[model samples]
Target: MSRITLELAKKMIENAEKEANQIGVPMVICVVDEGGNFIACHRMDDAFLVSVDIAQNKAWTAAAMKMSTADLARVAGPGQELYGINTTNNGRIVVFGGGIPLRKIGQIAGAVGVSGGSVEQDVQVAQAAVKIFEDFE
Candidate 1:
């Protein structure tokens, strides 16, 4: 299975943190490998404690599914396709905007997830990390 290096994980987290700081929110950021194994998690000062698990779950869900959680939210909505998916994966799937898969060398490398901000802010933070990962490649 593909994996993310600690260096890359740090870069992703740094970018996510930068976005969170720009948005004026303390965030919990997580990076998970392609197999949904945790690589790193960073909880900023004053970040909501509840967001720690949420961030990790978001990263795991994104890497495992190879899709953004925001996209999942569409299909996983009540009465929609993939409904109850969140309940099936040991309750790990995060059907929201904070999760984004990280692709490297044309394959899934991992994912980054951010929390402690609004959904839009979370998406923005994750996107920043995605861009950094792409540039790192």
Candidate 2:
């Protein structure tokens, strides 16, 4: 399992930024390794100050859990397998669509998180970034 190089993390941020710009939303984007270690974090000029923390938490959650935050949100709801999971990890878990696990050959390498937009727009930006990473070696 290869780690997420700084180069790849930058690429993810660059692409995510483009998407956010096109959507007319400033954004905060973060990437974390499989161990939930920070690889990179970026915030657009007009992005909300609070979004920085949310973006980082989203990436951390996705990486630590080895799953997309969107998926986690599904199972983390009331009466679900991961109920109260958000309360764990000292509240790091975001359980939202903007965080996506980046996989290399079906193995988790890292995760990307985007914020400062609607959840759907954030997911779109994150998905674009992850798609680019998937095509890289």
Candidate 3:
């Protein structure tokens, strides 16, 4: 898999921030590489401190699982075997709506996540950032 470059991470963060700002929603954005390592992060001034950790967890879940956090939530049904995966990663695998996989040439390159707002708002911000990669030729 291709590595997520600093430039790409920066762009994703910037776009996510812009989207959150446009909607008047404060947010913390995080990007994680394929190995679930942090690539970059941004927290809006009014964003909650806890949002940083939440965003990172969302991104880690996406990167490590190679799927959107929304999908993970579906598979991690109550009492399902995979449900434990959500907590197995040291509480760093959040199966929520604010995370999305970053793809390059149809392969997962990394993940982007957003927090500090409602799940819908956070998902919107994260999706805006993921669009950068999705739309890339």
Among all candidates shown, the one with the greatest TM-score:
2
Q: What C-alpha lDDT do the candidate models reach, one value each?
A: 0.89, 0.89, 0.86
Once fitted onto the true fold, the runs of candidate 2 whose alpha carbons sit more than 4 angstroms away are none
Least well predicted 10-residue stretch by lDDT in candidate 1: 1-10
Tens digit per residue, CA lDDT, model 3, 5-121: 888788778888889999999999999887788889998998999999999989988888889888888889788668777768577789779989887778878889889999899
lDDT tens digits by residue: candidate 2, 89-137:
7988997789998888789888998889888998999997897788787
Instruction: Give per-model CA RMSD.
Output: 1.5, 1.0, 1.6
Would you estimate the TM-scores of all the predictions? Answer: 0.94, 0.95, 0.91
TM-score, predicted candidate 2 vs. hidden true structure: 0.95
lDDT head-to-head 2 vs 3, winner: 2
Off by over 4 Å in 1: 1-3
Ranking by TM-score: 2, 1, 3
